[model samples]
Target: MESPDHPLAAQCLQTLPKIELHRHLEGSLRISTLRQIARQHNLPFPSNADLPALVQIQAGEPLTFANFLSKFQPLRQFYQSPQIITRVVEEVIADAAADQVRHLELRFTPAALARAQGFPLNEVMDWVIESARRAASQRGLSLALIASFNRHEPLELARQVTALSADRAGSGIDGLDLAGNEAEFSALPFAGLLREAKQSGLRLTIHAGEWGGAANVREAIQDLNADRIGHGVRVLEDSSATALARERQITFEVCVTSNVQSGVCPSVLAHPIRGMLAAGLNATFNTDDPSISNIDLTHEYRLAVQELQLTLAQLKDRVLAAARASFLPPAKRQTLCDSLEIELAQQIST
Candidate 1:
C-alpha cells in the first residue's frame, strides 16, 4: 500500500516520542511472519498471496464487526508452540520501537494463546512475561504486560487469569483487561473479579462504549472500577456518562482507524475524539490492532492532525495523558510522565 500524502505531518509525528496504552499481541503479528509460520507448520494455505485477505481488512470487504473479528480465527492457528509465541512477542516490541513508541502496554488473551495447542495457562503466562521482559530490555523501551480476559468466556477462566495476573503483579504482568464482543456479552458478570483484582494491586481497563452504548461505559467506571477505558468514544451518547467520566477523570484510549474499520464510527473524520476533548474528558490516541488496521502510532497521530483537525499542542497533550494513565507503579509512572513532558516540550517548540 502507498503511503498517505502528508509529508510534514507524518515526519513530525514519527519523530515525536509516544506512548501506546492499547495494543493487542494477537493482532500485531506481521504477515510475513505468518506466512513463514504457515509454510513451516504446513498449514492449509494455497499461497502467500491469500494470507493478507484472510488476516487483514481489505478495501472491498464489508467493514462490519464480524468481518473485523474473522481475521483472528486464522491467527489462532499460528500459536502452535512456545518458540513461535516468543518470536511474536519480540517482533511486537521491535515494531513499537520502530514506530517511536517509547512506552507500550501490550495486552494479550491467554485463552487465545493456550487454546490452540492446549498449553497450560500458567505456562503461557510465564513465557509471555519472560519474553516481554527480554525484548523490552534489548529494545530500550518501557514495556508492561496486561493479561486480557474475554467477557464472553466463562467466569472460572476469568478468575484463573485474574489470580495469575495478581500473583505476578510486580514481576511482569501489571494490569487486567476485559475485552471481547461488547455488543453481545455484558461486562457485569466479571465486575466482582475485576474489583478483587484491583484490590490485589492490579490495574483495570475495560472495553466499553464501542460496540455497546454509553451505559456500558458507566458500568465500567462506576461498578467495574476501570482506571482507563479501551474505546469509550461513545460516552458522548449520554450526558450522565459524559459527566461521570469528567468528574472522575477517567482516561479513554481512542483508536481512530479501528473504530472506522469495525463500523463503530462512519468514517475516520467522524470519530468523537474531538468531542471527547471538548467535553474535558481525558482522551489518548492508540492503535488497538495496528497490523489488522494497517497502521502504526505515527499514522494514528498524523490522522488526528490532518483528518480530525487536532492541533499539534492537543496531540502532545494526548501523548502526555497516555503516559500518566499507564498502569505502572507510582514512582515509575511519575518518572515516565516527567521525562515525556520534557521531551514533548522540546518537540513542540521546534
Candidate 2:
C-alpha cells in the first residue's frame, strides 16, 4: 500500500542495494498469510473479526500508538505450528530479498512465538533460528537474527532470551534486542543482563528515544551499552544525549515512517532523522515493520529523498554506513561492505 510514484523519484532506488537493521518479525506478518493460516488451522477468533483491519493499519485509521499496536493483537494467534513459523520466516526473508536488501538484521520475539502455543521458549528459538538460516540461504540474502525481548515482560524471561542468544551467538542468532513498550516500561531493569550479553559477544541494540525521551537515549547509550539505537529519532532533544551519541559514534537504526505512523512523530515531513544525522550521529535508514506500516525499504528510501530532502548520494552513504554498523564480525563485515560497494558502483554507473 506504500506504493509511491512521485515525479522526482526517477532514480531506480529499488534496484539499489540496501541494509535494514530494525525490522520486526511479529510486525511483518502478511495479512493474507494470517487469514490463510487461521482458516487452514481453524483457529479461534471473534466471529466479527475484521482480520485485515485488525492486523493492518487501515486507510484513514487513527495514527495513534494504540491503533498502531492493535495490528499485533490478531497476529499473535497465527503462530500455531512449526511449519507455520517456518513459512512466515521464509516469507519475511523472501520479501526483503525482493526489495533488494543486501543485508538484513531481523529481530523476532522468542517469547511472543512461544506464548502462542505454550511452546517451549528454547524450542521456539530453535524454530526461528533454523527457519531464518534456511530461508536466508535459499534467498541468497545475507540475514542475521536478533533475539528480541519485551521490556514489559518479566526480567527472568528476558534473561532466558538473552542466555539463549548468547548460547548460540555465531551459529544462528547474531544480536540481542530490547523491544516493546518503552513509554510504560523502563529499560533500567535489564541493564546488567544486557551488558553481560554484550560481553558474551552478542551485539546489543536497544529500542529507545522513540516512545521515550532523550534521557532514555542517554541511558541506552551509557547503561545498556547499545551497539545501535533503534528508532532513535528523539535523541536530538537533549544536547547531552546528542553529544554522548556523537562521542560514542553509536549507530542509530532510524525507521522514519514507522515513527510517524506509530505517533512517535507527527508526520514524516516533521521526523527528526535529518536532525539526528546533522548532529554528527551515526544514522542509517530502516523499515521497522514494513507489513504493519504498509511499507517497504524502498518506500523508506523514496521518502528520504522526497520528504526528508536527502539526496541520492547521501542515501548511498547511509547504506554503506548501515553495512559497517551491521552485527557481522569485523572480517565478514568488511567482505559485505566490499561486495556492496561494488554493486552500488555498478548500479550508479549504469
Candidate 3:
C-alpha cells in the first residue's frame, strides 16, 4: 500500500534496515491471527473483528481517546493465554519483518495478563522471552523486551515487577517501565523501584505526557530519571520540558497514528513528531497498538510521509534514532548500524 514512486515511501519500502524502538507485543497482533485464535480457542469473536477490513473512518475525523481505548478490550481477551501471547510475539516480529525492521524493543505489562491467567510474572516473561528468541533466530531481526508496571496497579506491585526484572537481569529482560493511564498515577512513589532496576543494570523508560501534561514528562525525567519516553508528545507544550529532553538527548518513541487515535493529538499532521525532530530531540516512530488501530510498521512509516511530509534522510535518521535506543548490546548495535548503512547504499545504487 506504499507508493514507491513517492521518494520518502520508496526509501522506506526498499528494505532499508529499521529499528522499532517502541511497540507493545499484545497490541501488534495480526487481526486475522486474532480471529484464528478466537476460533481455535472457541471464543465468540467480535463482529468488527476482521483485521483486514477497513475500519469505518470516522466521518470528518479520527478516534477519540475513550472510543479508541474501547477497541482494546476484545483484543485483550486474546492475550490471556501463554500460547496466545507467544504467538502474538512471533507474529509481531514477522509483521515487522515485512517493513524490513532489523531490530525492535517490545514493551508490555506482563503482570496484567499473568494475574488474569493465574500465572506468575516470571513465567509469563519467560514465555515471551523464549518466543522473542525463537522469532529473532527465524526472522534475523534483533529483539528486546521491556517489562512495564501498570501505573493503575498499587505502587507495591510496581516495585515487585521491577524487582522481578532485576532478578532476571542475566536473562533476556532489558529494561523496566511505568505505563498505563498516567492520569491515574503519580511518578513519585515508583522512584525506588526504578532505582532498583537501574542499580541492577536494567534501563528505564516510562509513559508520560500522553494523557497527562508536560509537567508529567518533567516529573518522569527529573524524578524517575527515565532513559526514554513512550509518548511524551505533550512536552512540546512547555519550553522547559522540551529543552530538557533535547539537552539530555532523551529519545521519545513517537507513535503518530496511536496519538491521533487516542486523541492525544487531533490529527496526524498535529503530531509533534517532526517538531520534536526539528527541535533536536531524538524521535522514533512506532505502532503502539497495531491491531486495535489496524496499522503496521509500513502504515506508520507512510503516515510519517503522507501526513508529516518527512524526507528520505529524515526517515532514515528516525530509524537510526530507534537503533540507538534499542536494548541490544553495544556490539550488536554497531553491527546493525553498519548493516543499515550498507543496505541503504545498495538500495541507492540500484
Any runs in candidate 1 off by more than 4 Å, and if so which?
1-6
C-alpha RMSD of each candidate structure in angstroms? 2.6, 2.9, 3.1
When sorted by TM-score, best at the front, the candidate numbers are 1, 2, 3
Ranking by lDDT: 1, 2, 3
On residues 1-350, what C-alpha lDDT tens digit does candidate 3 reach at each position? 33434775555554666678888775666667767776777666645444333322234444776676666556656666888878888888888887788888888778755764678878888888899889988998888888988777788788778878888775889998788778877777888888888889899888998999999988888888899998899998899999999898898988888888788898787788888888888888888877767677777877776678875566767777788787777888788888877776655332
How does model 1 fare in lDDT? 0.92
Q: Write the per-residue lDDT of candidate 1 for residues 309-336, one digit (tens) a residue.
A: 8778778889999999998888999999
RMSD (CA, angstroms), candidate 2: 2.9
Stretches of model 3 off by over 4 angstroms after superposition:
1-14, 47-62, 348-350
Candidate 2 lDDT, tens digit per residue, 1-350?
11134443445687889899999999898777887887888987644367766777788888888889888887888889989988899999999999999999999999888778999988888999898888889989998899999899899999998888889988888999998899899999999889889888899999999889999899998988898999888888899999999999999999988888888899888998888888888999998988998899998998888788887777778999999999998998999999999988775542
Q: Tell me the number of clashing residue pairs for each predicted model.
A: 0, 0, 0
Can you give the TM-score per candidate against the true fold? Answer: 0.97, 0.95, 0.91
Q: Tell me model 2's lDDT, rounded to 2 decimals.
A: 0.87
* Residue pairs in clash, model 1: none
For residue 286, what is the lDDT in candidate 3?
86
